[model samples]
Structures are given as structure tokens and as C-alpha cells.
Target: MNTIEEEVPLGRRRRRRYSVEFKAQVVAACQGPGVSLAAIALHHQLNANLLRRWVEQAEGNERFLVARSEVSVPSAATPAFVSLPLETRNARTGEIRVEVRRADQSITVSWPTSEAAQCAAWLREWLA
Candidate 1:
């Protein structure tokens, strides 16, 4: 007693649109030296793996890093440290701070005293 109409399905996919400016920025960040792809991707909330693919595709292009100096790091007397401020997890008596070396990217966790050593270690390992 009921009549039904036939349904149709479109098998085509939609094309995504990206601005030229965005593509240029991505390309620049990918090729820029002294900056990690991880950091760039993190800033843009993009996947590092995908950004690496873009870099690979852009390799040998005019925009690529033609000079070796762009990627070289000079030796310094003191290692640069980056303060990675840690949020207090609990109401503890001691304080902890995580720092990463800008020169070598090494991470170091410091505590106020020996009593906080365990907490510092945990933060270091967990952050790593």
C-alpha cells in the first residue's frame, strides 16, 4: 500500500581549497633552518608526518635550502637552555622546572632540593 522513491548516491569527492599565502608559509617553515618541523607543525596544529611529506615534495625546488649555512649550528661556550615551565600538578612542598637546551635539545629537570628529586625525575621522563 506504500510507494517508495529510488535514492541516488554521488560517488564523487569534493576538492579542498587552500590559499596561496598559506601554502607559501608552510613551504617557508618547512624549509626554514634552526626551526624544527615538529615545532612548526605544532604551532600550526598540523601533523609533522604530513609536513615532512610536503618538504620532500618540495625538495630540489628553488625554495629549498640552497646554502648549508642555513642549517649549521656554531659551537658555543655555554649551552642554551629553554625554560619549559611546568604546571604544578599537586599541592607539593617543592617546586620543579623543566628546561630544554636550545643547542642540543637536551632536557633537564631541576628541583628546589633533594627532596623533590623523585618528582623532578618523574616530570623529566614523563615530559620526554
Candidate 2:
């Protein structure tokens, strides 16, 4: 009875309230390039987890949805890296040689650094 009486005076602590504009600013900082959400939260003396929730809420907003809908999403299946066989000649000579192997078939091509685009196009054509 005494403990209840004592607790009644303190009651529950009030929850912290933040303005929408402040939340939007923090969320925007989290989205900036090379910006860390935890660092931002620490700088602002806020909980990182709370900032992440705000980010989720912002992303789910109708404004974000409309902007996201305008951007094209790539296919889930990304292109695999092709095995690029490298051959090096003498160190004195700076030349590039790329070899591709498919089952029993193999191809060898040598190109100067300046003609890399042509070499890439030729490789693509040959592979196709």
C-alpha cells in the first residue's frame, strides 16, 4: 500500500515528441551519400533504431512512392561475371591479352589499352 502510494506521485514519464519537419530533416540526413544513420542519430542525440523507423515511414509515404514509381527497377537477376583470363607479357611491354574459354572452345585476343572499347565490342560479338 505504501509502495503504490509512492508510485502514484511519479506516475508514468511523458513520451518525447518531435515535429514532422525535424523528423524529415533527420531522415533526409540518413539518406545522404556516405551518411551513416547511427552517426546521424548520435549527433542528434537520438536512438538509431528510432531514426531507422522514421526512414521506413518516410520511404512508405505517398510522395516517396510517386518518386520511386518514376524510377526503373533493374531485374532481380543480375548479370554474372564472366571469367576473364588474363595473360601478361614482359613488364617492359604494356599490352593486354584476354582469353575466353567455353567448354572445349577457346578464343584469344590481344589489344592495346587505347582500343579497349573495340576489344570489348569484339568480345561481346564473339560471345553472342
Candidate 3:
């Protein structure tokens, strides 16, 4: 890891310059199956964000592509939305009922469904 440590001004942190070979090696490790970028960064004593940038940059470089081809890369798949079934509720006589129970005491309150927003606000305030 041929890093050159140059002197910096006061209040400024020293910047590290990693060799091209070292960056390529780290980036290749990140491309492995089931590999964690964070784990690789921690293992190499590198910032996670900096390692991420190296991987991104390596994706566009031919040298990295050749190295990546040596490993089996997973195919990227497009994400699909799944529809969920919603529970049906009766519209007639619609009401919101809440039960509050404390030690040795319980209270049940029914509020009109039309005032659900106000009911939510009241519950928030009461709970807080």
C-alpha cells in the first residue's frame, strides 16, 4: 500500500493516497459473492464510503472488468412491485373503538369514524 503522507496545515487532516493496485485489490474483494462492503472496509482499515467510490470507479475501468470477469458475478434483476390484499370493513355504522387498560382499571371509548383524525390526535396527546 504505497501511501505518501504529506504534511498538512493546522486543523487539517492528513490525506492518504492508496496505490492503484491496492484499490483494485480492495475493489475486487468487494465484488465477491455475498461480500459486505463495510466488512471489507473494516478489514482493510479503510473508510466505507471511500471503498464504495473505488468500487463505483472500478466498474467503468477495463482493468477492473478483466479482474471482475475472473469471479462469478450475480446477474442484476429489476425489482417488481407486489400487490397486497387489504381487509374489507363494513361502511354502515362505522366507528372507532379504543380500549385503555391500566392496573385494576379499564375504559372503553367509541368515537365516530368520521372524526378519526381528531381521535388520533387525542390518542397521541393522551399517550404522551
Candidate 4:
């Protein structure tokens, strides 16, 4: 069954121990395109839940290893946050503007920027 039976000291209970290679093989099968995990588990004579846990552990370990390797590699081209100059406008003079055009009629509405919530509600009702 591709597993080793280990006898526990406490009782007559024996635990099944799967090799790393066998686990990797099963996990790879589960990751195949359009593959059913339950079907794979049945083929391997393993419980579906245990196979699922193996798959999760494999994926999590892969992610952790990848993250660790990335952190170890130092690249000059790696992106870093840089401050950029932004155009600043007076908030008191700012207006929430909306332009609506239908057929040949055009309407322009401007609301105070401070009442943005009310302007949004009004715009929603107007559009609806």
C-alpha cells in the first residue's frame, strides 16, 4: 500500500507512515489538470480527507519555500516605493462636478466637495 506500518508503544495500535516520494507522487496526481482528488485518493487506497491534507501541506510548503528563496535573492531591479510629486488643489474651492448629456440636451451639476456623500446619493437617484 506504499506505506510502512509502525507499532506505537502505548497500545496495539499501528500507524501507517507514507514516504516523502509516495506523498509527492500522490500530490502531483491530485494537481493534474481536471483531476478528481477523491478518485486519486481511492486509487491510492487512502482516505480522501488525509489525501486532501497532504495536498494542502504540499502547497503551503511550496509557497513558504518560494517566499524564502525570493527573500534571499537580492536584485537591483526590485521595485521600491518612491515618492512622486502630486498636483495639489485647494479643497475649499474644489467641487464635485457631473456632466450629463442626452440626445441634444446637456446638463452640468456641481456640488460642494465636502458633501461628497450627498452628491453621490443625488447622482445615483438622478441617474436612476
For model 1, the superposed segments whose C-alpha errors exceed 4 Å read 1-17, 61-128
- For model 2, which pairs clash? none
Give the Å shift of residue 45 in candidate 4.
0.4
- In model 4, the worst 10-residue window by lDDT is 67-76
In terms of TM-score, how similar is model 4 to the real structure? 0.42
Question: Per-candidate TM vs. native?
Answer: 0.33, 0.41, 0.43, 0.42
lDDT string, candidate 4, 1-128, tens digits:
53654545776766678766667667766665567999989998999999999888877897533443433332225356899987545355788777889999998888888899999999789779
The number of the candidate with the highest lDDT is 3
Judging by TM-score, tell me the better candidate of 1 and 4: 4
- What TM-score does model 2 achieve against the real structure? 0.41
List, residue by residue over 1-128, the lDDT tens digit for candidate 2.
11111223357765567655566566766665567889989988889998898889888797754544454443235456899977556234655688888999998767887777897898799779
User: Which of 2 and 3 is ahead in lDDT?
Assistant: 3
> Candidate 4: which stretches are off by over 4 Å?
5-11, 63-128
lDDT (Cα atoms) of all candidates against the true structure: 0.58, 0.68, 0.77, 0.73
Residue pairs in collision within model 4: none
What value does the lDDT take at residue 64 in candidate 3?
A: 66
Q: Which of 3 and 4 is the better model by TM-score?
A: 3
- Candidate 4: residue 67 Cα off by (Å): 17
